[model samples]
Target: MIDPKLASAAETFTLQCVINKRPVSVDVPPAKRLLCILREDLHLTGTKRSCDIGRCGACMVLVDGKPVNSCLTMAYQCQGKNITTIEGLAADGALNRVQKCFLEEGGYQCGYCTPGMIVTVTALLNKNPEPSMAEIEEALSGNLCRCTGYGGIIRSVLKAAEQGGRRHAGRHESA
Candidate 1:
């Protein structure tokens, strides 16, 4: 029932990468998607999987401080990279400013797209603490949210900026 060539065990490779703030090692096939490696292999389910072809931002994750579609990234390519999933956004028990703003602004509804949206916004705000509406829209163009209607999400980003969240841009202040 299995294709011999595709299921060959000879291709397994040990991948070493930093995840969240910790280092992780995994044995995976070269072609295994980073999405599967994170969700299925590592059991970090906060990074959602939708539209595996990479059109949707549901699988977005921060790779070396930049937002990347995990579905489009290969496991081998992640070697020595710093990968941060949604679960990595918060430190200890407290949420980062971005996460707190999302909650206060009602940025999420179904929650499917929230992680990716937050990931993108985090990267954007880190790079530009005071981004304009146009810049925010352009940065979030890849993330699609069907439930929230974008109003709450926009407000969340704006609120995060207005609150002088630069102190907690990529990491919590206490972190």
Candidate 2:
């Protein structure tokens, strides 16, 4: 038998984090997943929730400028951190080069995995402005796409890099 007190009430904490480019503070249980925080509380649905145990990269996001599986990351772990979702990749009502390239290259079909794929690629391009095909493959190893095949996605990444990786190559942002 488990202790009733231990399970009766969940402990909560004040989470302070920078989401996208804005400051946000919220109260949540420490064990709660960041995926839920983004999709539910914060209402940033661009980050998808799938395979809650972290098997899928659908809930991937950038934490401190590196890709992280939000599903596996707890709320407390995000405290005082900078998080970037798919929505953050764009600015001023304009699509970022990576995003535009994806569209131009038809990088998605079904589209369930596009957000996570883009987030992961965004981090990679930001870190390495001109990544080779092998490098892109290695960086995206953790991200799985079931539709649209990988041809278009690869082309999109290549095209984004060729386009100067504007959003990615111009500047670097860290948590």
Candidate 3:
């Protein structure tokens, strides 16, 4: 049996965090994961929640420009930090290079995992613009794709790094 009183009490807290370059303050539970906060509270559904654990990369998001699993991260952990989701990747309706690459390479199938994959790759490329194939595999090691065997995703990322990355190199500084 669930206790409504307890659940409600557990569902509320004071949260102060920066999301997508905007300062936001809201009341949420301390134990609620950032994934929940983003999807439910802030309404940033781009960050998907899968596996309910860190095993799946569907919940990946940028915390201070580094990839982190939102499902395993508590809302409070995002306090006073900058967080970016797939929605933030495109500025003024312009897709980021990584996103463009994903599209060009058909990096998505079901598209459920694309957001997390894109976020993870963007962070990886930000750290190393010219990462080797091995490095690319290593960087994406944390992400899992049930559809493609990573050949297409890796190729897509490489293409993005080589082409659009140059343009983004001068702008859209990582992190």
| Candidate 3 backbone clash number | 1
lDDT of 3 at 56: 78
- Residue clash pairs of candidate 2: none
Expressed as tens digits, the lDDT of each residue in 89-158 for candidate 1 is 8877668778889999999999999989989988888888889999999999999999988999999999
TM accuracy, model 2 = 0.89
RMSD of each: 2.6, 3.1, 2.8
> lDDT (0-100) at residue 105 of candidate 2?
96
Model 3, range 1-175, lDDT digits (tens) per residue?
8799877767567888788878999887787799999999888888888898798799999999899999999977887899888888767778887888889898988888888999999898777777788888888887889988877898899998897566566444543
Model 2 global lDDT (CA atoms, 0 to 1): 0.87
- Ranking the candidates on TM-score from highest down gives 1, 2, 3
Model 2 residue runs over 4 Å out of place are 1-9, 165-170, 173-175
The lDDT-based order of candidates, best leading, equals: 1, 2, 3
